[model samples]
Target: MTATVTAPADRLLYKPEDAAEVLSIGRSFVYELMAAGELEYVELSRRCRRIRRTALEQYVAKLSPQSH
Candidate 1:
């Protein structure tokens, strides 16, 4: 027998790649942000990490407008 898993309708956490897509940036940039403490994430295990939805929202909210 095999079981399949499905994601929730509303996601509370996102993988780095998913976060990058949400932010419209590169995955490597997401990691860089995490490394620089610019982005927040929850470490699930030794090699697993996830970013909270609110964290992503907060990151965008904290961004200053660019001068033209």
Candidate 2:
């Protein structure tokens, strides 16, 4: 039997650690990108931040050498 994979729901969001894993980088790098204004994120509260899938993809695309 074959199993099919399903994508995450639209409302699903990822934290810095998750984004780091997806990008194969260190967690500190993710924060550095955010501090450098390279990655877009939303502040859920005074201390909470969330990164969207779209933002992560855009950041990767922007960093691609071909984009330069």
Candidate 3:
């Protein structure tokens, strides 16, 4: 039998490539952001990584200016 997995209510997580596309940057740049702790990611395995939509939103918010 095969098992099915459901994505989170918010939505499925973004892969590095998807994240890069969303940010309008390169995949390497996404890795750099992760390394610099500017972006958060989840490690599913030694070879698998994903970025939550909320984390991406938070990162962008951090880069945005505060309103008066």
**Winning model by TM-score:** 1
Best by lDDT: 1
| Candidate 1 colliding pairs | none
Candidate 2 local lDDT, 1-68, one digit each (tens):
22222325673567889878877889999999999999989999988888887787677666634443
Show the colliding residue pairs in model 2: none
Evaluate model 1: give its lDDT: 0.85
RMSD value for candidate 1: 10.1
Q: Model 1: what TM-score?
A: 0.85
- TM per candidate: 0.85, 0.76, 0.75
Would you list the clashing residue pairs of candidate 3?
none
The C-alpha stretches of model 2 lying farther than 4 A from their native spots are 1-11, 66-68
Candidate 2 accuracy as lDDT: 0.76
Model 2: what TM-score? 0.76
What is the lDDT of every predicted structure here? 0.85, 0.76, 0.80
